[model samples]
Target: MSTDTEALARSATKFAVPESLWNDDVAADLSPPELLLYRSNLLGSDLTVTNFGGGNTSAKLEGVDPLTGETVDVLWVKGSGGDIGSMKIEGFATLYQSRLLELEKHYSGPDDDDKMVGYLPHCTYNLNTRAASIDTPLHSLLPFAHIDHVHPDAIIALAASSEGEAATQEIWNGKIGWLPWKRPGFTLGVMIRDYVKQNPDVQGVMLAGHGIICWADTAKDCYEHTIQLIADAASYLNEKLGDAPAFGGEIVAPNPERRAIAAALMPKLRALMTGDRPKLAHYSDDAETLEFVGSADFERLARLGTSCPDHFLRTKIAPLTLDPERLNDQAYLQSSLEDYRAGYAGYYQRCAGPNDPAMRDANPVVVLVPGVGRITFAANKATARIAGEFYGNAINVMRGAEAIGAYVALDEQEAFNIEYWALEEAKLQRMPKPKPLVGKIAVVTGGAGGIGAATAARLMREGACVMLLDRDEAALDAAAAGFQSEFGKDVIRTAICDVTDEAAVAAAFKSCAVEFGGCDIFVANAGIASSAPFEETTSAMWKKNFDVLAEGYFLTARSAFTLMKQQGEGSMVFIGSKNGVAAANGAAAYASAKAAANHLARCLALEGAAHGIRVNTVNPDAVIKGSRIWDGDWRKERASAHGIDTGKELEEHYRLRSMLKRDVLPADVAEAVYFFASDMSAKSTGNMLNVDAGNAQAFTR
Candidate 1:
């Protein structure tokens, strides 16, 4: 007999969900879709049951499209960033049955969870007109029309228990198929699809410690199955002497004008990073969430995530705690923001990896009011709805678990591992297809200021998760603050790394993963200049210059290639100098090191392509507006040595060179790096692009 049967035989001796229990109405007065949404939202909020961005849910309504007149069927699935509890009609997207089935046939070799959703029909509809949930495919995979996937405390309490799988098998028997937790997304869909196809008679799938999937031909059937299954699990728990402790927590007062609070906070947050305003969602104008946020255990609870993994993707790892004590203090608010950001920095330090995405700015996604209510944050309305639902459910679970024995969620390191795993990090690499650049992690060494800063900024604007690795702590802080001041903190991140050290470089890359989620575009822009004749260019001068330019680039490229290879895709760009191509007098070490850097990039390009990684170099000529190479005494001396006035030399150089006649600028060079870092040059690997404004040809002059 199947393990499920043997377990079922054992469970047969325990209390089961009586057939009559199905007749009792589920509380909360939710419609079929709305009920599923509410339950999912609740589950999404439960840190004891779900992880941030981990789980998904769906409901299917068969209907013929009037536009087609033919039997055109569609399955409305939950799109990514959507949590079921507060999910609205706009949070769902309709995929034609034919398309979902067609997508099933062409199994791309195991892809990331979020990108796997991209393979679904193009989002032709807006969230307002048509929202799409990421779990739509998992729902579509079920034989039944209505399906729900949730991570519940009582349920996972059973799943993660030592006898969990066996217990579930016994209770569920032939009715449920247990699936080991694979990372959710396309691979997950493939796993479920294969299982369902193999076990055609199963009514549900239980994932160990992950959650449970239930389905039925109708919404009611699906709901009944879920409720009964959960009840059965709860019964089993009670039998084992597990009693859900009484809910205990004092409620805080609500903020009367909560909506105004959310609105005023948006611009302040947007000022911290580059992106659209995050959407906001809330429940109970009275603010139960606020009370929950102010609970004595709030700190530990706030940092903790949902019970299962999938919840993290929806609610993030944790919600922002709005302290009641600092309610009216602006300084306190500022300090709160600072504290949150610093905490994120610490989290990055603890959890980041070599290829992880960088941390976006730290902004509150969900605000737990002391007495008022909970508030959800998002870049758009759709995401807010998702946040609100997932967060609300998560808070509810925490509150419930607190009544028993404090919600014991995953540790920071565990959360970090999942958040920065290669597959999940791959989502950071996703860009619009048929585009300029893709699958490249460019690290602009010295990226905290000047051209390095500009290069990092330009790369992100061009769709790369730019990792700014610089030794200048002051520049790093200023750049991070400046970027957060403008972009809202989620897009860009800075690392204080001395690139010459291999260990430091490796650690910095790991931090990049924790900060942004992954690294694909690398710039290697860190370097220093010296203007001395061959005799004056001492051993110290040679070593220092080579350390930054040659050794630094080598370490960075090696790290980038390792991550890219594991991910099966990536790109790297080296910042080479015009002096490297044609020597400049009195700058022997700088020139030679740059030449070595260029060759290093070319060799990487040749080898990286085999692993689906592209490598390239950008040769820039005297484009130094804020560079150490061009400022103060260095500029005048170089100009005098080259036999022309500084201003006149730059002008003559630009004019005497080629047709464009424009002076090379950091932005211009950055644009070249951006092109190679993105899909614009997908097939152009092992290449070198010049951003020298014709000055490359002038080297011969």
Candidate 2:
């Protein structure tokens, strides 16, 4: 190695991208398409290499034509909106190489390049339904059999540096070439093809203000080259980096109580962001994030905006930075958010063409606070988390670029064009309509129980992110795991919380705020059943019932109310027992406790009405199936009271005793809870719904 290379190797330790993970054994038996997917996954596994859905990979391979039964060259590229890390083979769009090449005849110039996307459908090789990405032409027009186009933070740092071309020439000498920025489309693809033709000896080219495109004859060679290039850039940046602190040193020290501050601020921030529609949030206060937010150049660098298209697409043109000292000042925070929205509106108005899509919600997706860190809001938890990740990548790019030279951002007009492109608008339109509760956050007490789990499922089905709270850790994990598997891990979180403990209750709700921004629905479904004749009832039994049924309800509801009030709207659903109204013969303690809980809901509803908080109840009778309360002593006691057998006979006796002769289930109660939880009962509050198989005695008077 040269003296400079040896010195770089000695000095560079920070920000190293992991070596290539490709294994010969893993790739040996895979087909060409599968190998392409494997290559994409290996490169995309690390955020330092590429972000979620931010890069594309393509393979030119021989495929049998269905009609002709002859082998033909085909191009398989990452489909539109597909994440390379997690995408399957089916996520790749297939097109005929010859047809893609023929598209050159239709392209008039850069002005008509966007029209080229319309012609891609005619090039589909096997009638593949996966939509081809705009980057398709960039890959197809290249001569290599395998290509990887990725936005690695390390390489992007060089691309985004003001001295990027000089640095590229310095680092690689003539092995790598450089091209000026051009939005990814037919025109840019032609530019890349021409550049490669002129510099056939060069392995790749860094696209200024964007990323890098590298290719090789084999997928393994391409993967290795990509990793080596990124590693070299990271080392070069690290070596060039002096002893100075990043972002011009820290302007504010990270507060140890930053999470507490974030929890308090999130609901208010969410309230402001929800003017157009509800939004879920993700908070990050990691060391790296804190460093960036607390840095002196935070505002300046953020104002310059992210250089990569993927970064700004998720994070927006820029983030809104708040004064850390004014975080607790509600009016100040509100004014700051309003000012941000106004700026965003002005940005849209200035850049929008006559044919551009109408301006979207002006609320900022990312918020930066000096001491606290970064918070991102989006339509759901995953998107919010991904946005935070993308911004994190942008931060790294900025750090590296500043180390090498002055960081630069894409031009304002170019950024606007990409942000509001007609094709991008069409992609947005193609997304499935969001569910009714798309941005709502919910918390279910006794979340491991049948009723709680069912209610959580119901709310989640409508697009609400749920936090499951239960005292039983094992059951909570099992329940959360099931939901995570079905609904994805992003939408579900678990907390070990006993509802009766005020501290635990408060902590659980705080956790909900930190995990999902704020709670919009609180399902008070935690309960325990007790039975005793009036003469046999003890003070201990009565106190136990009240402590759980009535007091537990109070603590959780109070916490929920506090959070919801900050957000300006919420719904609370209390799961009461049918006996609370009908008065069971041998269950005085359970019955009276539940009655108190029911009455409490009415009082809260009356008080919360002016604040847009809706409180309601769903009373379920003899929910024998899938009910934890029905599994033990309560079942035996109720059966003995009716002189029936302990198992199926008791269930049948209650079913027959009901006016409708139907057995109630947890799912039945959940449906009632759902109605109250959603906007379906928006106009009806301070009310109760009976899921009791029509027992007139339990009906609300």
Name the best candidate (by lDDT): 2
Residue 132 of candidate 1: its Cα lDDT? 54
> Candidate 1 residues 1-701, lDDT tens each?
33422332232122223232323356347665565565555544544334445456666555555556666556666665655555665666667766676676556666456555666655232223453555566776655667777776566655444455666777677778887656455677678878988998887777754678777775556656776777776565555533322123333334455544443343333233323221222233323354455345656677766655655555667766766556556566667667777776788887887767777645656656554456555543334555676665555445434432346565567667676766455655663352232222356788875678788777655444456788889878888787777645545667789989888888887655433334566777887877778988899989998998899889987876765665556678788878878777888988999889988887888788887888887888777576755776667757766667887665576456645776777788877877777667878876667677765453533
lDDT of 1: 0.62
Query: Backbone collision count in every prediction?
Result: 103, 0
RMSD of each: 18.6, 3.8
Error of 1 at 594 (Å): 0.9
* TM-score for each candidate, following the candidate numbering: 0.45, 0.97
lDDT for 426 (candidate 2)? 89
Best by TM-score: 2
Local accuracy by lDDT, each model:
0.62, 0.90
Clashing residue pairs found in predicted model 2: none
lDDT of 1 at 440: 26
